[model samples]
Target: MSAKSTVDAKIAQGKRTVVFSKSYCPYCRRAKQLLKDANEDFDVYELDEFDEGADWQNALAEKTGQRTVPSIWIGGQFIGGCSDLEAHQRSGKLKQLLA
Candidate 1:
């Protein structure tokens, strides 16, 4: 199956805290760290480590209208990339997604 379709299937099932990222990306690391610090459970798609990475990223951009990592989705809402998520954390809006 295509990486794009794989991602689509997962999303259709539920959000369940999914993040599209690159293992070597600092921003991705920062985002994951914040989630970890918050004790948040999430699944990760380390694009850089996947053979289908390019396909996945292309699909992610097409679907989310954004081409960046860490692309975060919590509770069925696409919370955007790393900085965007940080803004949510700063504004205390992150908990709402967790709950």
Candidate 2:
């Protein structure tokens, strides 16, 4: 399947969180850590580690209009990067979304 298709399928899988990240990105680590601290189970696709990494990132950019790593989605909805996740957590929206 195409990278775009894979992205779509993963998002549509609902009730799960997905993060398209890069192993060396501090933002990615921060985002992931937040989720982990919350006891959230999520899937991580470390873009820098895979052959189709660029393709996946391109697909994600097209889908979400955001080209940064730690591109996150929860329950099929696009959630912004690390700072956004932090905001959500501060407002208690992250917990609501996870629930």
Candidate 3:
């Protein structure tokens, strides 16, 4: 199956999503905390632990279209970093998305 399909299946199963993060990123920590506070389980992939080569970063950039840490994808949809998440939460869209 495609990666997107796999991600969708995981979300449908009520699994926590994945966040690509880096150390020293407050946004990443906050994003994680928000999920935890909402009682959502999520997995984090530390980009710092992986090779910082162009290929890996490029792949992420292509997916997110931004080089920012804490790039989040939910149900295979690209969700921007912390501020974007907060916006969704404030707008009540996040609850529906999580539901």
The TM-scores of all predictions, comma-separated, are 0.91, 0.95, 0.77
Show pairs that collide, candidate 3: none
Give per-residue CA lDDT, model 1, range 26-81, as digits (tens): 99999999999889988888999978887899899998899888888886678899
> For candidate 2, what is the lDDT?
0.93
Name model 2 segments beyond 4 Å from true.
Answer: none
Residue-wise C-alpha lDDT for candidate 3, range 11-79, written one tens digit per residue: 445444667777778998898888777776676766677554234445667656787878776776778
Best model number under lDDT: 2
| lDDT for model 1 | 0.86
Candidate lDDT scores, in order, read: 0.86, 0.93, 0.70
Q: Which pairs clash inside model 1?
A: none
Candidate 1: Cα lDDT at 56: 90
Residue 13 of model 3, lDDT score: 55
